[model samples]
Each structure stands twice: as structure tokens, then as C-alpha cells.
Target chain A: MSSPERRTADGLERAQQLVRLKRYEQPDEGYFEGFLKEFQQRQRADLMQRSSRSLFCERLGTYLADFGGRRMLLAGGAACALALLFVRVAPEGQPVDAGFDAPRGEVTPVSAGPLFEGEIDLWEGMVVPAGDEEIDLPLFMVEPFDSRRAAGEPEIIEL
Target chain B: MADVKKRKPDEDRGLVERAKDGDTAAFDELVTKYSPKLYGLVYHMTSNHEDTNDLLQDIFAKAYRSLRRFRGRSAFYTWIYSISVNMTLNFLKKRNRHWKISLDDVDSAIEFDKEFIEQTSKTDPVRESNIHELQLRLNEAMMELSDDHRAVVTMFDIQGMPHNEIAKILKVSPGTVRSRLFYAHRQLQNHLEEFRR
Candidate 1:
């Protein structure tokens, strides 16, 4: 770092004095007049070439600026307030909302009225019996010519 | 420190109002009023006549486009200076280190300036140096500075703007402006002290 000594200041002061000579560097005479004319031409060309969107915005801005500072401030404040409305702040002690309008449907438990007193039957129709019983045939008495007995007592003849 | 005309805010308000109302004549007045000063500011920064010319044209064009946004929050002087400084700084940033220094002709009127001659007489080396050569060396020394530093130095040293005014233009604190000026002056001294100073 250069110290702030008298000798150092002198050297810098001399250099600074030289730097001041930059003021003499000027464009040729009548440059300002020419600059204005050239600028006017370019300004007209640029404005002519601009899209309607930019022109509208420029017109709107100029209109707004014409409405005075108080109105501008009011408009700015209203915009901020509107922006704040859209920004939902989370309540204290609640987890912040990261979801953006997620689906929300309610759940309902199915009601088949109240329960009755009974063991619940889960296997009611699948049982079968074991086959190990002995069978005796009755002695058959042979009765021949039983056609008349067909109508007697509703015909209970065992075969 | 320069023949650059000072701005008049009261007169500016009327002209700005008129210009805002689509008075091309009033806008022309502003363009005429400010071009030379703005030219000097930008020329010193870029160290190129063509770049300065183009940039000056652009600066005024931008100001003209942005006229509606200019509420009297700051003086037109400060507002336009802000625009020029910002645009030139951006231009310099984009053109970084890829520049060829092209300067304008030193006005012949400088020959008749007694104060400059007197100041040079006080310094043996500066007095002994050729005016054209000294001017070139000075511009080269200026280019050695960073864009930010060069900006403050150009505005403060060459343009003779008050530190507070420069602070306003840069939107930085006055201390920042002063600090930049201090370091810039130091660097310039170092560069020029080897021979020119």
C-alpha cells in the first residue's frame, strides 16, 4: 500500500494534474449540433421500428408518471398488497405447505349394521362324511301275482 | 477544471416537462445541453473516439426512451450522469482488455490557459514533457486503472465533480468514491512516476 506521505502525495498530485489534461480532449467543432441531428434521426427510426407492445408500455409509463408521485406510490403499494395476498403464510406450529392445491377426498367406513352373537362361519359349505358302515339286506318274501295289490294301501311293496 | 457547462435544474424541469409532453424541440435542447459533458465522461473512460461517439448517441437515446421514468426523484443531471456512467461501465466490461486507445484532438484553446501552464511550470518534469506526449501518457496511465477506479478518477479529477455528486451518480457512498479516487491516484502516480512524473 502506498503511504500517505508528503513525497507520495506530491508524486500523485503531479500525476493527477496530468490526468486533468483529459478535459481538453474534445470532438471537432459543431459536433454537438451534428450529434443532436443524428440522434433525432436514430430516435425516429428506432421508434418507428419498435413493436406495438413496447410502444404501449412506454405510453403507459408516461401516463403513469404524469399521474404524480403520490399516485405512483399508491399504485406501488397496492401492487405489493396484491402480491402479499397470493403468498399464503403458514400459521404458527403448523408444518409449512409444500403441496400446491393437492386432491382432498374424505374417507367413509362401510356400515353393515351391528354384529350378532355367533361364531363367525368362514367354512360353511365344504364338509364330507367317512365311508365305513356295514349294511344288512332284509329277507325277501316272494309274492306272485301281485297286480290286485297294486291299488291296495297305496302300494308299499319292498324290493 | 473544464469548459463543460453546468446543469440547471430549474430550467431543466420546464424542458423535461415539455419534452415529456412530446416536445421534440425541448428534448433536442436537453441533448445539446448534455452531449459535450457526457462525451468527455465516456471518451476518457473508453479512451476511444469512435466508441465514445457511438456510446454518447446511445446514452442520449436511452435517456430519451427512459424520460417517462424520470420523476424528479433526482436531478436530470444526476439521472443522465447515472445512465452514462452505467452504460460506459457495462461497455468497458464487455470490451474488457481488448481495446485500442483512440483519443480525440486536444483543443488548441489549451495553449492560452495560464493556470495549466503555471501548474506545469511548478513541476520540472511535467513542464519539460511535450504536451501531446504528456496527454498520451496520462490517458495510458488512466487506462491502467480498473473500470470502476477509472470512472471515479475521470469524474472527480478530470470532470471536477464533487465526491458527493459522484457518489450520487454511482449510487455508492461518498466514502466508496473517495476510496476509489485515492487508490486510482496512487496507481496513476506509480505508473507515471517511473518516467513522466
Candidate 2:
């Protein structure tokens, strides 16, 4: 026998030519009939599988609808309860009554505490300084308290 | 095997319609009617009789399940072909591995061809033998193609489907179908070039 590969090549060429020439034909009746039979059997089996799966899905749906459905309802209910619980537990930042605001212009000043006692006051000896020369007390001379500082500005605070 | 007289074309059409409408018996009739072709398709694509049998079962099962969704956009035959092609491609994808091409046990066409060639072999053994070898190699080369290429080849070359019909079935443009056939045939020619000698 010639090399199988060589034979195979010839056959391949012929087949391609045949296919190209539109000479390729379907099988004979007996073969088709056999195929039809096999197809029928397969279809029946397929139908059965589909029905089985359909039945399974239907059963599953029904199960979910019947006894098992409560789980979802319970889940929904649990979610609602948790949400309400969170609403209750979480802090509310609404402005609490900054009790009554006095009318805009009706401001009041409080009485000062007692003046400096003897030992700490070298200031008691000094007269009120002359014109354009306001006497600078240590309290006044020190840098004024910055409101931004008191309100937490300059986030990088020096120790 | 007891022969089940195949349904007439019109009856087959009706069966497909009924099956599409959720009639199990009609679908069963269709399965009976077309199983062999579909099996051949799956078998050729998979190259394993057992795998073909199993895949055939699943293909029909899927077709039956999805029958309700099959709009008669294409002929039921074309529609079923589409299903077969899709299923086969899906199977190949899931396999993610190379598969060899295996023809069904010498089809009548092959048998007849063999007989004709052998008769001629008595006079020109070398030439005829070359042809036989070439055909086998062609089949082997065809099988070595990716499933997509193989599918287009089967439809166009083996089944003699029109480009339009194949395009519709494959959900691709006719140009794509033609290009695939061209490439597949070229590959086959190259693989079987020695036979041209």
C-alpha cells in the first residue's frame, strides 16, 4: 500500500474538488432514516429532561411561595427592624435650644472681679500714661487672643 | 431496526410549529425526524460517538427548553441548525482543548466513493490510491481546524448551505461565512497539495 499520508492527500484533493464542484451529496435513505430514528429518541429524552427541569424549577418556585417564602418576608422584616433600630441609635445633630436669644441690641456686661492685690501689681504705681501713649499692661501687651485660635484654627498647634 | 417512516416536509413544518408552541409530542416528532442529522453534526464536530450521543441529548434538551423562544425568524430547519451550531461551539468553548476530527463510520458517500475508486484502482492503482489517501488527509486536516472554521466548512462544503442561510444560522454576515469557507478550503488545499501531483 502507498503511504497512508500520500493516499490521504489524494483523497483530500478529490474531496475538496468534489465539494467545490458542488458534487457533494447527502447520505442515502437508509442512513437518513437511521439518523431520523436516533434524532427522535434524542428528542424524547430531551423533552423528558426539560420537563424534569421545568418541574424542578416549578417545585422550587412553589416551595419558595409556600413555606419557605416566610424567610424572605422575615428578612424584609428584619431589615426594616434594623433600619428602625439604627434610626433610633444613631445621634441626631439638630440644634438643641440655644435657649432664648436676647434682642439684638440688649447686650449686658458683667461686673469685673476684684482688682490686682498688692504684691503682683507693679502697675498700681504707674499713672494713666499721657496722650498717644496708652500704658501697655502685660495683659494688653501680650498678643491678643485669636478667636480662630480658640475656635481651633492653626490645626498644627505648638506644644 | 424498525423503520419509522419520516414525516413529510409539510408535516415536519407543522411539528416544528407545534413544538415551538410548547407541544411536547410535536417536539418529540421533530427530534425523531432530525436526530440523525443533528447527531451527525455533533458527532463530526466532537469526533466522539459517546460525546456526540451525550451532546445530542443535551442539544435536543436545550432546543426543547428554548423551543418557546424560537421565533420562526428562520425556517425551523435553519433554526435547529443554528441551535446545533451554537451548542457545538459552546461545547468546544467549554472544552477549551483541541479535538481530533472523526468521521462517522464510513458514510454511504465515502463507501460509494471507495468502491468507485477501487474499481478504477484495478486499472490505475497509483492514481486512485493517491486520491483515497488525499481524502483521508483532507478529513484529518479539516478536523484540525478550530471549531468555528470546522463549522463553516461543514455547513458550506458538506451540507451545501447557501451563504445567506449559513450566515443567518450562524448569526454572522454572509461575508464572514464566505471568508471562513475561503480560508478553510485554502487550508485544506495546502494540507492536501501533494495529492495534486
Q: For candidate 1, what is the total of clashing residue pairs?
A: 0
Per-candidate DockQ values are 0.32, 0.12
For B1-197, candidate 1 gives per-residue lDDT tens digits of 33323545455898998998889899899988889889989988988777898999999998988898788788888899999999999998899576655444334445556676676678767667776667667778888899999999989988898888899899999999989999999899888885444
Which one wins on TM-score?
A: 1
Candidates' TM-scores? 0.68, 0.53
- Model 1 TM-score? 0.68
Q: Write the per-residue lDDT of candidate 2 for residues A24-138, one digit (tens) a residue.
A: 2234557545654676676566557766777788657655665557798899999999979977776688544446984556668977974432222333434344445555556
Docking class of 2: incorrect
Best by lDDT: 1
DockQ top scorer? 1
Instruction: Provide backbone clash counts, one per model.
Output: 0, 17
Whole-model Cα lDDT of every candidate shown, in order: 0.79, 0.63
